[model samples]
Target: MAAENIEQENSKVKYLRDKLEKAILEKCPDSRLNGDKENRLPNTTNISFEYIEGEAILLMLDKYGICASSGS
Candidate 1:
């Protein structure tokens, strides 16, 4: 795809990322990614507040008009 298309896609991605991040930060303040410096993905995430029901967070974004991948 062209840069414009890519930028547009990123726009949507950013919105979802923002929402998810805000929710996670506020709702799960204890969660933090676990790893050394080399194991992390840039602009990526891997956090858990030991949340058992939090997997549904991915689905929550869809209800808010944002589409997102589940980092799979």
Candidate 2:
């Protein structure tokens, strides 16, 4: 059961990441993805929006119930 649960969660994370990546690339072209997509943790993503402050992004994401770190 534990292994199955892990697989399920990984699937969800992959889906979310793919969606987020597409959305950002299409709607926010100025934004940047921090690491190599082919060589990163399954459940971790880092994006840097151009010409924006980290705190501002954090606050907006927080309002939408998305928890993120600034990596400061």
Candidate 3:
């Protein structure tokens, strides 16, 4: 039962992550998702935007209470 619940929760997270990725790509055509599409952690997303400073993006997201990490 516990394993089933964990699997279900993981599926939900993966679905949401895919949706978010689609939205991000739609809004920012210059952005690209990093890492493997099918073999990545269900809860994490890494996206690289062309011509944007990572720190600046992080600061803007922070203003809206969004927590994000950058590798730049």
Candidate 4:
């Protein structure tokens, strides 16, 4: 039962991750996803947008109550 619950949780995470990735790519054609798509953690997504500073993007997201981080 515990294993089943864990599997379900993982599936949910993967589903949400994929959905988010799809939405971002659709909205921003110049953006690119970082790291391995299939091998990375299910809950983590790294995307880079062209012609925009990463810090600026994070700040804008924060204004909308979105929590994001930068590696720089």
Candidate 5:
């Protein structure tokens, strides 16, 4: 069976991404954002939390219904 695809762009994704990036930059001084703001994947946000465990952060975010993954 062929995979179904949607052609429409989800503007909501960009809107939410912008909001999240703004919030993180403003509030999380220890976070190191992993991409150039001017040239970044719209659907990907990678951050490294200095002095914090990635797994711990992921677990906390999961409790809040934010789906995230780590390479470490």
Candidate 6:
């Protein structure tokens, strides 16, 4: 069902977001990021590293073999 697929996708996104958040916090501590921003996508995260260009995040994603959307 369409709804089931959506739910599955959402679950995967949620899991990825959780893992990503923990990793980011640990590996990039003191990276000058937004302290209290929230995830606008259903189950994805958007973090803004203050000193890093946003495009740089794309390079990291590419390094990780992830194909993600850039928010509007």
Q: What is the C-alpha lDDT of each candidate?
A: 0.61, 0.84, 0.94, 0.90, 0.76, 0.67
Q: Put down candidate 4 lDDT per residue, 1-72, tens digits, no spaces.
A: 878699789889999999999999999999999988889888889999999998899999999998888882
Clash number for candidate 2: 0
Q: lDDT per residue, candidate 1, 1-72, as tens digits? A: 477587677667666655666787787777665555344434555555555445586578678885556455
Which tens-of-lDDT digit does each residue in 1-72 have in candidate 5? 223332234355667788897798789898877868767656677777888898999899999998988783
The candidate scoring highest on TM-score is 3
Candidate achieving higher lDDT, 3 or 4 = 3
lDDT of 1 at 14: 63
Write one digit per residue (lDDT tens) for candidate 2, span 1-72: 878699788888888887888898789978878779787767788888888898998899899998988984
- Candidate 6 lDDT, tens digit per residue, 1-72? 878699788878877877877798778865533334454564655555656666777788889998755454
Model 1, residue 14: C-alpha shift (Å) = 1.4
Error of 1 at 27 (Å): 0.8
**Each model's number of backbone clashes?**
0, 0, 0, 0, 0, 0
TM-scores of all candidate predictions against the true structure: 0.44, 0.81, 0.91, 0.88, 0.74, 0.54
Clash list (residue pairs), candidate 6: none
Model 3 root mean square deviation, Cα atoms: 1.7
Error of 4 at 59 (Å): 0.9
- The collision pairs in model 5 are none
Model 5 misplaced stretches (Cα beyond 4 Å): 1-10
Worst 10 residues of 4 by lDDT: 1-10
- The C-alpha stretches of model 6 lying farther than 4 A from their native spots are 31-39, 67-71
Candidate rank order under TM-score? 3, 4, 2, 5, 6, 1
* Model 4, residue pairs in steric clash: none
- Candidate 4: global Cα-lDDT? 0.90
